[model samples]
Target: MSNLFTLSSKLAAQLDQELMGPKVGFTLQQLMELAGFSVAQAVQKEYAIDDLNKNKKVLVIAGPGNNGGDGLVCARHLKLFGYNPVVYYPKRSSRTEFYGQLVKQLDFFNIPILEESDDWLQYLKPEQTICIIDAIFGFSFKSPMREPFGKIVDEVSKIDNTIPVVAVDVPSGWDVDEGPTSETYITPSLLVSLTVPKPCSKHIDTAKTSHYVGGRFIPNHFAEKYGFKTFKYQSTEQVMKL
Candidate 1:
């Protein structure tokens, strides 16, 4: 497979700003909706509902950031697309208006929203889940994961590799540009890089991991402004494998 442009964390943040600013004028809610939908499509494409065995559950471990919101939206869509998804969002963000709306929507779907608990591992076990969505961190995350996430990543590392872990954006505990610095970093089976892949995309083991680019909402003007190399998506698909 070919590669796409690798964006630094700074450039990524600036792109987000431009996308939301007056020129592009996209609301955060709108972007998140599209991103989450794209992610759901990718997941569905790779792990089809008909192919799943007796277990058809997806475990989405969401953080407290916009990535978490994307995960929430993804879980909701996955439910509509015929998969049971359970969300483990321990620390909800202070952006109550937006995140609360996501929660309300999940409630409407009757998806299980799990909080931080001692028994979190019960759901993380390979036999318990068909797939694991790691929506904990993004490119903005720095080294040394804090609080429950550090502990959570440790658990993720120990799970059986038979169950695929699909990381959203960047894998948790990995440096955005430098890639995995620690030995214990979680190795995702598949990575769904939103908008554009980060510089650390090169660090992932291509032979062992599958990477795809989602979030096809980037405007042409901004792409030109950043000198982003044009890449083709198959037909009308929102995501393209890289």
Candidate 2:
């Protein structure tokens, strides 16, 4: 019942302060890993009904940001758990070093990366129940989706209603700081919010309108000093305690 929007300004200020220094002590890679681990933990707990893992297929829609890095990590972990996750990345340039590293990791894992011209939609059968992981965009995405990304979003939206979607952070195309735009977006069945709950989570029109799975809010100090904070919402255990 906590209102995350009320703390947005404060959180934004803290984030700015943490990034103003010469080097980001806590690299985005570390955050992406933590986010991925947190989501894997949450999904394992929530979807443990009658050995459902045996037949489930996971589809990850990743972009070129830290958000996509998180999805790659999730795909790796999911594969280790005996699930094959088909990862789809739109043709785009990446700005984060962590994202580039994740792309390599995905390749190492032999995870198929779908391109815009691949006709990947044909693989997703209407009756083939799967979980779609939306990591296409995050809080920093401000511009309206265009071209291949827009086309990808449109294709994924056609997935059957029986298929559940797990969105990483905010849903793809939904603005985190602001509310939802008229642009295309995915309405995930569950949203695993990393670090802290995004402001859009509170908006009724946002894509994260269903169940929310909260992740740890790792303070910069944790990365700088390898010290844990006293905050109760910084880890999966802490979130479960809530």
Candidate 3:
């Protein structure tokens, strides 16, 4: 597995652009749906609905970008899988047509969507929350996080040891290729890499972190075009544990 190519931040963005371009013609919604669904599948694989007799309440911390959109979709599927998921979406995307629909689906499912407030921390109870999905940032993220997200990352770091946090793509506040560059960065117990494993993944402490790769939408020719090896996912699986 060490021989597998880990994409740098630039390459990761370029690959995404290529996927969404006319060559592949895949829409952002399509990719987000698959990526989010794959993440939910990874969650089910790691934390079963009845695992260890713990409660099924999951706290999903969503950002305002595409990664957050993935979280929104993930929460919807988690509910369908019978897990009680509550979303903490402080900032939302302005693309109402897309994000609005995702939000509507969550509302239709009767899932709780918590917005930013002075006492937002009250919703994040480690004892009551079985798992926390870190969807606050992705590979496109850079250093020096902004306002509430910076504070949010700090709080999540404090509770990292108490709750099992599953980071979507790159961990929040981490340098896309250099790994953790700040004290506010979160080290999630499990990481679900989308498309390809980012170069920063080399810094992951394999002994402490359970890594999984999802987003099985890359075509074989695309990998050849990019000169990266395609991962071999198990039969009919959307995600594979590494």
Candidate 4:
């Protein structure tokens, strides 16, 4: 499995270059928004349901990075479509600039952030629900879960198996470049990899339904600048066919 999914250091470096370089003109926020929309679109298509923008109950678990910003975007999109999507952002001091901007966007949209004190469990029933969006962690994570975030993951795990989870980028605690963490992790029903599939996608424990999201690829010049290449999934047709 490692041989099949492992990304060499050179390749990983190339990807990072493509992701952060100027040629692509794809900021982290844009990538995140595209990814969130793609995930929502895929969900609607997968369930063979109409009115996706206006249906379903979505619970978004957000962390402190750009991944959390993506979840916030998803929540706003869900609200526009008429779904009651609740966003929970665990308090953290070291948050990304994108996250702060997203918070302001949520405020403009009048979407209230869920407090830890709020009874989130009461709003979601494991057996008779729609979807849970996991955006708690992204590719850069390396440490074990700690404090309130770890506690949040534990609580979310308590949800019955009947509920389906759509994870953004990767599952909260799973490492994209390496293997699973030593601590407890969230197992998403469907894992949505933004831009391209990460090495972790090939892991047997990553997700039952792992799918790649599409966006503009990182340009080669940028990849070269950053010493990595970027690959965007062109399988939207296949996803639509599913």
Number of the top-ranking candidate, with lDDT as the measure: 3
Query: Model 4 misses residue 32 by how many Å?
Result: 2.4
After superposing candidate 2 on the true structure, give the runs of residues whose Cα lies further than 4 Å from its correct spot.
1-10, 13-24, 49-53, 92-97, 204-242
Kindly list the per-residue Cα lDDT of model 3 for residues 1-242, writing each as its tens digit: 46657888888889999899997899999999999999999999998867653554898999999889999999999999888899999987886689989999999999999888735576466667878999998888877798789999999898888888999999998888889987688988999999888877888888878999999998788887777767899898999988
Q: Candidate 2's residue-wise lDDT over 42-115, tens digit each?
A: 65555542464466567777777767777888888777766767888765446656566777787898877787
- Candidate 3 Cα misplacement greater than 4 A, ranges: 51-54
- Alpha-carbon TM-score of each model against the true structure: 0.94, 0.77, 0.95, 0.76
Q: How accurate is candidate 4 locally (lDDT)?
A: 0.64
Residues 1-242 of candidate 1 have per-residue lDDT tens digits of 33557888899899899889997799999989988888888888888866544456898989999888899999999998888898999998876699998998999999988888736677776667888888888777877678888888888978727778888888887888888875567888888888888887888888878999989886566677776854577888888888
TM-score of 4: 0.76
lDDT of 4 by residue, 149-241 (tens): 777777666662567777776777778766467377777777666655577767645335645543444555654554345553355431221
Question: Comparing candidate 1 with candidate 3, which one achieves the higher TM-score?
Answer: 3
Higher-scoring candidate on TM-score, 1 or 4: 1
Model 1, residue 213: distance off in Å is 0.3
**Model 1: per-residue Cα lDDT at residue 22:** 97
